[model samples]
Each structure stands twice: as C-alpha cells, then as structure tokens.
Target: MVPRNRSVRRTKAALQSALVDLLLEQKNLQSVTVQAICDRANISRSTFYLHFENKDEVLSSYLLQMIGRVHDALRAWTGSDDTRWTVYFAHIAHIAPILGSLSLDGGPHAILSRYERQFAVIMQDLVMPGRVPTNDTAVGYAAHYLSGGLLALTWWWVEEDRCGTPAQEMSRRYHALCSGQLCP
Candidate 1:
C-alpha cells in the first residue's frame, strides 16, 4: 500500500511538472492535449486517466497546491513584522508564466473562486476575530470585492512589464489600497 501511494505521488508530480513545462512553452493552454502531457511525463494515457480526469483537472490540482502554499504563508504571518505579503508576491512573480497561460485560457475562474472562498474564511477568522458581522451579506460582499480586486491587481502585475518593480513595492501598494489610501 505504501509503494502504491508513493507511485501515485510520483506520477502526479511528473504530470504536474509536465504541465508546467508545457504551459511555459505554449501560448494557449487550450491547445495542450492529454497525449502531449503523457508524452512529456513519459507516462501512458491510461496512467494519466488513473490520476486525473483531464488536463484541466491537472491544472486545477496544480493551482490548489500553489494556493495551499500561499495559505500556509498567510498562517505563518505574525503582526506587522511579517513579510508574508512580499513573499507571496515573489512567489506569484516566480509562477507568472504558469499564471500567464491560465490567463490566456480565459483566466482561471474556478481557481479564483476557490481563492475567494479561502480568503473570505481567512478574513473572517483573522481580521474579524471575536466579532461577527451582523450583516452577513455585507461581509460576503466585502470579501468578494477584496478578493476580486486583489486578483485583478495580481493579473495586471503579471501581464505588464513594470520595469523592475520589486515584489516589496508591489505588496506595499496593495497594502496601501487595502488601507483605503487612494494614491500609493
């Protein structure tokens, strides 16, 4: 059973790596095929189907792993001394190519939705600790708005060549906006 679990993990890792490589090489993710991924991973078609329903599933899985890392970073953050935001932005910059492919594929609505839900829960737990909003609707709206705005900003940052804008600067601007500052 342990060997089987290990094999599954290895296969999934190979598939994830292949997908990332393929995404980096291709302009459009829609054009990538299961067969191509299998070939790149040196796995058979049957093996791919055993783990993933399709290429989109593989992409979704990969994104969930990335989001999990971000969540872990957020959880580790402590007070004003934390540089989690900068670290998050640096991670995003590192994965910009993979994100660019997802953006090219009409953007990742599912992944964004997942992030929105996670962010909402995190906000409720951290930002509003020991207090519950009387109006759940308002809280929901605010959460959605903040999450969407953050996602949009991240998308813009990844798409544009900001001429060597450091992750720390970008994160500072994000914090400024979050703090209701109109001008960064």
Candidate 2:
C-alpha cells in the first residue's frame, strides 16, 4: 500500500535518498549495507523494515517512482505522436545517474526490462480507438517489439555517458531507427 501519512512518506524518501548517497559514494550497490542506510537516513532499523525488505527494495522503490513519473509524462504529452520518445527521455534525465552507478552489472538491464513492460502498457493505453490492434496477439507482439527497440535506445543513451546526446537526439534516433509501426 502507498503511504498516506506525510511522516511515512518522509521516512521512505529519506531512506531512498540515503541509498542514493551511498551508491554515489561506494560506486557499487553491493557495498552498501542496511545499517549504513539506517544511519544515513537517521531512521530506525524497525522503521526501515516496515517500509522495505532490503537495500534493493529501497532502490526498486526509488526507480519505480522515477519510472512512474516518466509514464505520467508520456501519458500527458500533447504534442505530435512522433515526439513521444522525447517526452519519455526527458524524464530519464532524473534516472540516468542511478542507472550509471548500477550499469556495471545487469542492474540496468533489469530496470530497462521494467521500462519495456511499462512502456508497452502506456502505449496500449494511449492508442486511439480507431487504431486498435486487430488481435490481442498482434498487440502483444508489437508491444514487445517496439518496447524492445525503445529499451535498446534507452540502454544506449544511459551507457553513452547518461545521455551524452540530448533527449531530442535520442528521440530523433528512435523515430529514424523505426517508424510507422502501429505501436509507434
């Protein structure tokens, strides 16, 4: 359940912030410890446990919140359809730092897969009634294909100096790489 009380929200934010700080300092997630997170956040271990199972949980929650924001941007964008990628990548600036630290292993890949899944849903939701897929199977395949391409683009952007090129360039690359897909 999402926390409603402001105090609960504050505690969760502190824990996440502490984890980010630790990741920044350590250069690796495995080196960070729960006790360290508790100390950094100045929250009790019991309180931490109430909100998270482990350090990874804290990271996941933080990533999800970021992803949720991106999803909202994609949903709320009012510009041309071709610029959807820009809308999405624009929010990624907030997440690139975390992905950079986690990119050493498959951590970034895990998050990218989540992005694919979430993007597929967002695409389906945004589809016009007139453009509905002929069948559920077709939609599923297209979602996988398009979101996979998007994932690849995002991975490249993150690894390439956390968007060495701007989000507009990334979106341009996406539209150039593949266009006219019903999913697009």
Candidate 3:
C-alpha cells in the first residue's frame, strides 16, 4: 500500500532519491544495499525497513513510477494515431536512465511482467479492441506475444543502444516502421 501522510511520503521520496543517486554512481543495481541506502538518506535502517522490504522493492517501486508516467502519456494521447510510436519512444527515452538501471537480471521478472501486462492491456484497449480474436486463448496469446515483443524491443533499445542513432532519429524510424500498422 502507498504510504499515507506528508512525513511518510517525504521519507519514501528520500529513499527513492537516495536509491537513484546510488544507482547513478554504481552503474549497476545489484551493488545497492539497504543499509547503504538508509545511511545515504540519513534515515535509520528501521525507517527504510518501514517503507520497503528490500532493494528489489525499491527498484520495482521506482520503475513503476516511470512506467506509470509513460502509461499516462499513452492513455492521454490526442495526436494523430500515426504519431503513437513517436509518442511512446519519446516517453520511454525520457525515462530510460532510471528505469533501465532497474532492468538487471537480479531484478524480479514478475515485477517487469506485471508492468508489461498493464501496458499490454492498455494496448489491447487502444489498438486491438473488438479486433481481438474471438477465442479467449488466442487473445491472451496475442497480448502476451505482443507485450513480450514490445518489452524486448524497449529493453534492447535502452540497454543495447541497438539503433546507434539519436533518440529523435530512432523515434522517426520507429514511426516509419509502424506506419503500415498504424494506418491499416
């Protein structure tokens, strides 16, 4: 459950901020330790424990906030449907540094899966809808497949620098690649 009250919220924010700063310096997630985080934030280890169970919880919580912002942008889309990929790429790129750090193998795939499922449901609502296959099995498989592809592409884009191009250029190419699907 989300913390209630101003002090709890501030403590949570401080923990999150300290976590991010540590990540920036470490260049990896597994190196982070709860005691270190508590020390960095000037909070008691008990205080950190009060807010998060472990480092994984901290990373998941941080990534979810980034994912939530992108999801909100996707839901609020009002531009040409053709611009959807551009919007998505821009949103993901904007949040890449923080979120990407949390994508290490040490992190739980279940957390990533949960967020991807949410994104898939949103995509189904926006992009598939009545067009979803009549068979529930088929629709489930389709959503799962599509969500995995998106997750893989996004992961590769942020982690591998696969495009070897600027984000704006990659966004352009992404839109171009999906033009056929976006239109019809």
lDDT of 2 by residue, 100-156 (tens): 788875588876676677767765665533376645777777766777877777777
CA RMSD per model (angstroms) = 2.7, 3.6, 4.2
Residue-level lDDT for 154 in candidate 3: 75
How many pairs collide in each candidate, listed in order?
Answer: 0, 0, 0
Q: Write the per-residue lDDT of candidate 3 for residues 1-184, one digit (tens) a residue.
A: 4546888889888888889888877766778888888988999999998989997787778777776776677667777565555666776676666556666644434556768777667667656778856457777666676667667667778777553445555555545544433311
> Model 1, residue 80: displacement in angstroms?
2.1
Model 1 quality (TM-score): 0.85
* Over 4 Å off, model 1: 79-83, 109-111, 129-138
lDDT for model 3: 0.70
TM-scores of the candidates in the order shown? 0.85, 0.84, 0.76
For each candidate, what is the lDDT? 0.77, 0.77, 0.70
* C-alpha lDDT of candidate 1 relative to the true structure: 0.77
- In terms of TM-score, how similar is model 3 to the real structure? 0.76
Q: Which of candidates 1 and 2 is the stronger one according to TM-score?
A: 1
lDDT of 3 at 84: 59
